[model samples]
Target: MQPSHRYTRLTAIALGIAGVISFGSAGATGFQIRENSVKNQGRAFAGSATGQDDASVVSNNPAAMVNLDTTTIRTDVTLIDLTAKFKGGGRSGAGTPLTGGNGGDPGDATPVPAMSIVVPLHGAFEKLTLGAQLSAPFGLKTEYDSTWVGRYNAIESEVKTIDLTLSAAVKITDRFSVGAGFVYERAEATLTNAVDFGSGICANPQTRPLCLTPNPTAAAFGPQKNDGLAKVKGDDTGIGWILGFQWKPTDALSIGYSHRSEIDHDLAGNITFTKPGNVAAVFAAGGVTTYNNGPGGAALTTPSTDTVSVTYAFNDQFRMMFDAQQTDWHSLQSVDIKRANGNLITSEKFEWDDTMMYALGAEYDFSDSFTLRGGVAKDESPTNDTHRTPRLPDNDRMLYSVGLTWNANEHLSVDAAYTRITIDSPDVDVVSSSSSTLVGKFKGHADLFGIAAQYKF
Candidate 1:
């Protein structure tokens, strides 16, 4: 092989390895997780920013902490089951048929847990309340068969985040309250994909001539004849802030608003390459053994959000709640990966748009010990077909939820809820810079079960 040919192939390998690290699918529309509060989930989060019955307000809306009256602790866990099936075909950069079966279901089942505590002070600090919360705000996981037709696009993709918040609220007046919080968030990701060594060598003009050599061994390294694998893992930490206000003009109605600042992360990690015997021999002949492992980094930003909610009681036995939320996802325009020395490796474009979510909920008091809850929500997707990726197959969806709060005793209450999400089939036709393409249609849905226990002292 010529020197220029080796350089071209090495560059292609670098791009494939770096581009695979993606914060992937399954959650609220666009890689955002919304199962932090089971009580809120029971009502499809309709009045999450205003309802103050549980310690979850520490994270949902700090201003609601003023209504906790006493010390409270809440713990919740939600199980999420997702089904993602793809039907499609793809081709190598050299325009050769990529041979393999459609990838099997890449869906996953995961558990999300959350906990919070709130304490109201008395005496000199009578109007002040303090709280703390731990939750997973954004997460994703999707794995596909290594031998799938789209293996060159993705194999395994996962991202997880943990957030700890410290909040405080003060009652400004008998009918008004204000609050703020500081959030410490950490994010981690791991991704893998098949590396088409054959396409990398045969697609480059400088190397194509060698691929046509008379020797059969020289011709064997062409489209799908030889393949390798690449994997990358990384983690980062960031800080953000939250602010909120609550007002009650009448004894039966309350309104609330909350905002969370965006967090920025610079993920530092390493990429590893695994090559088959034939592929390694070719690279070794070119004196490129060091390309097997190296350090890299990527920049990511968690979007900011604003929410407005209202809670109203019509009579002693019936109540209604509504909410509207907006997320600034447009800040994330692309994913650019860089070497440890600050050299650009590759770029993945997202071009996501800001999105809006709305929900409506109702509650009926079946008895003093039981309250039934149900809600419906409409959530929008930020991705467009032109920029969609197999790592994150998503679209607009509808959510339905039903649950109940059981007052086990004066100081303890248990909440259980079930939620279902139906997503519109999203189509994908992505062509990487290397000229490889992944064309397909995805069918997806999710089921969630949540339970929470809150205690007051």
Candidate 2:
């Protein structure tokens, strides 16, 4: 077959495989758990020891569940709005430039939801407890208009993830407790873009007749059209485990620690390349062109991960929490494509590395029914400046939060919290060789609203 035909067919297969994996995974973003309890917001999230809160206690340190006085059930819901701004940056050179345009503006917003429930096995097993939780640990969504000028690298992209967990807590002694749990997770993602071939260079038809050589660009573009969109989706399921321990050396002092193991996922999906008639006609008008055919094969593998958290409580009135996490991003080095006829096409290597994050929080009691909390955290950027794309122009970020809890009555309580995140713009280099750098910066801020109901029987 002609090179153009081979390229189109291969790309179509890759897009298809990616789409299958993304959709099957349930659209997970892997954004991380922002809230575990109404009270947790105050101490930054120190519930590992003073597991007074029902939901967070189970997810953060299940062993603490053995201390419950009665069987209690709780649920919380949170809404988040994020606004990102891009500033600075200029476009130079004439080749269908890859960067520039409203280089500074607000991007998009994201919303997240979570829930958990815990029960004590008192009569038959006084020292044993069981609990379950549903949360979103990682996720993000971003879309840049095609006219934004960064279209060559990325235009629109979104990722969403969900995790369901079941846990058991057991008390080893009056002063020590241990626990373990299992997790089921799902994820999904989508990316679309239209790369440009400058009118003078690749598009010139004259100066370089072979400018349209059947290479990576031709294989990716095909005869379907010079400008088009590649849509891909993927999904998968995976298993993970968690272990935790808590120590109460004295009535006034408590210490706790927990570790969660990572889960590996293999994603499968479908991809579709849509081109304008002008572009498709170039290959074969009203018929199959070297580009109009479907390629249909590709796969992505995401590796396992780990997280550690520690909590310390001084008396029943005050507490503090610390958390750290590491992700195996290196596993995402490249997207491998396989043709149905058993052939290897091109590979897209991201060459990503591991990343780490840190967080701290504290809480204080104001009265029997009122509590106050505050926390701060720092998160590192995952992408380097060389490969940064508008789909996720993220940089290192700082977070600040405050919260309150009110005991409305013996059987009821109310919780509320607010958090803000700040990000700085980083210098970015586009794909174009001559016009490599773009002048600009990015900023983002968000607000959160939450409410939860708890009851004891």
Candidate 3:
């Protein structure tokens, strides 16, 4: 059986929503979040897999939990301030100059929080440890002026997630330990953009004849004129697994390795459009489907990651650490959206490349109660110039960090950390099917401040 015209129209409208649903930004790279632990962030996460300094290890390397002798709890929060601005010009589908100011600073400050608890077993299970953690492993947010020259490309884009992890670790011997974890993550996204109803109608072969005639509707709407609004919202939950091992070959050195599996989600939601009065009249007069609202969904995959870290203690008062990590961003070759009946609506191309991040750090015991920390890192971006867009103008970046740890008492400690990320300016040239060619350069940076407290019982 053939689909109805209304069904077909809904499919077409949903395609536009899917097109912009692929938007994202990154605090780490490609929308991954890395501010789960203030103590780790202080060292640019260099020794995360082997640091084992607090309960945060439950999420970084569960195997390291074998080193915790008592029950411990840790909580942390980080305030991230991001700045991304665009300087450029654009043209409409009709090859006419698009007019509007460069969108104002589209970046905003956001807070990320996390918590973890670890408990050591007693008696026959003395070598066993169990843990739980709550964190945001991936997220992003960006908003542009509604009337900006690139409005047709994107206006607002946001993605948020919450992850809960249950983990276990067992000491096989004095020198080796292994661990594993199960994760349940929930994700949601909301994106918006302007739609050129005039150009879209005139560009459609089925409707072009109507547009060419002496119709008041055609006269009132043309190219960049009579714009409508499109919005898409979706949410889903997924599961993944984590495996890791920590090895101590000598009293002064610790080495760790960890791997996280990928997660897949089929986000379900609705797409809605708001048309102007003139456009509504035109659609009504021509007996065209209004393309108002309908069900839609998209399939997304959170990439996997692998990391290796080493921490060396030269003396009781100081130590140095190093980490190398890689993300399998190739899993994101494309994003495909579908209708409620399972028919494909559209697919957006990404072709992202896998990337790696490296960091080095050191800690110095300044006194019996105070420790100082410093670090640096190089974070690679997954997207290149050809695939970059206004919704996500991410680029390679350098990170510099410093922090302090205070042991207030035998059972309590506090950590404070700060970091600056400098991003390289990259040019963007996005050509739209609607004839809107957005050409420009982007400047971006971020500052992060974090604090955490840990207690042992």
TM-score leader: 1
Tell me the spans in candidate 2 whose CA falls farther than 4 Å from its real position.
1-33, 36-38, 45-51, 88-94, 98-100, 103-107, 197-226, 285-308, 328-330, 337-345, 432-440
Per-residue lDDT over 1-457 for candidate 3, one digit per residue giving the tens place of the 0 to 100 score: 1212322333332434343334545468778888889988899888989966779888789999988999999999988888888899977765678878888888788889999999999999999999999999887688889999888777888888899999999999999999999999998878777777767665666655545657655475577776878788888999999999999999999999999899888888887878899777767776764455787787888889999999999999999999999989899887776777876755667788999999999999999899999999999988878777777678888989999999999899999999998999978898653556899998989889999999999
The Cα error of candidate 2 at residue 195, in Å, is: 4.0
Write candidate 2's Cα lDDT for 28-123 as tens digits.
Answer: 112344564655554444343446565566666677777676677777776666565666444423333344465333345354566777787867
Which stretches of model 1 miss by more than 4 angstroms? 1-25, 213-218
In order of lDDT, best first, we have 1, 3, 2
- Candidate 2 Cα deviation (angstroms), residue 26: 20
The sequence of per-residue lDDT tens digits that candidate 1 reaches over residues 1-457 is 4333433434322443333323444558888887888878888889999876878888788999998899999999999888888888888777887778877888778889999999999999999999999999987688889988887777888778899999999999989999999999998877777777777767656566647867856586787777777777888999999999999999899999999999999887777888888778767776654456878777888899999999999998998999999989998788776778887766667788999999999899999899999999999998899887787678999999998999999999999999999999999898754357889899989999999999998
399 Cα displacement, candidate 3 (Å): 0.8
What is the TM-score of candidate 1? Answer: 0.94
What is the total number of backbone clashes in candidate 1? 0
The CA lDDT of each predicted structure is: 0.82, 0.58, 0.81
Kindly indicate the candidate among 1 and 3 with the higher lDDT.
1
